[model samples]
Target: MNSDKVLDARGLACPMPIVKTKKAINELETGQVLEVHATDKGAKADLAAWSRSGGHELLESAEENDVFKFWIKKG
Candidate 1:
């Protein structure tokens, strides 16, 4: 997925990825996408829930080489 900005949250733990994603998404305009790279296994569920509650759209997510990637569209 194409993203307006990419956030490298690899190696970070729990709320850190969500926290950084929140801060990064806040800088984007509505409809823009933010691509996040993370190593935290829990981020998959955490971000999905955060996106819903925060009003952002979690377009898609995937994992490669143990890294989880998520594409989120700002709402």
Candidate 2:
């Protein structure tokens, strides 16, 4: 899917990815998609939980090499 915005949170740890993702997602209108690239292993679980709690849809996620990519649709 196409993303409206892209957030690169690679090399960050813990809540940084979540924090940046939140900020970036807020900049988009409803129904828009945000693609986030993060290297933190914990970002998977963190973003998943954050998305659910924030009422956003976690459309897709995948791991390539050491990077994690997430496609989230704003709700």
Candidate 3:
């Protein structure tokens, strides 16, 4: 997925990824996408819930080489 900005949160733990993601998404306009790269094991669930709670759309997710990638569209 295409993103307006990419956040490299790899090696960051829970809440940290979510924290940075929140900050990154805030810099985007509505309908823009934020692509996040994280290594946190809990990032999948954390980000999924965070996106839902914030009314953002989690467009796509994948695990590549132990890294979790997410494309979130700002709502």
Model 2: per-residue Cα lDDT over 1-75, one tens digit each: 799999999999988999999999999999999999999999999899999999999999999999999999999
lDDT winner? 1
Candidate 1: list runs displaced more than 4 Å. none
Return the clash pairs for model 1, or none.
Answer: none
Which numbered prediction scores highest in TM-score against the true structure?
1
| Candidate 1 per-residue C-alpha lDDT over 27-58 given as tens digits, one digit per residue, 9 for 90 to 100 | 99999999999999999999999999999999
Full candidate order by lDDT, most accurate first: 1, 3, 2
The full ranking of all candidates by TM-score, starting with the best, is 1, 3, 2
User: TM-score of model 2 relative to the true fold?
Assistant: 0.97
Estimate TM-scores for all models. Answer: 0.98, 0.97, 0.97
- Candidate 1 vs candidate 2, TM-score winner: 1
Q: How many clashes show up per model?
A: 0, 0, 0
Q: How far is candidate 1 from the true structure (C-alpha RMSD, Å)?
A: 0.5
Model 2: lDDT of residue 9: 98
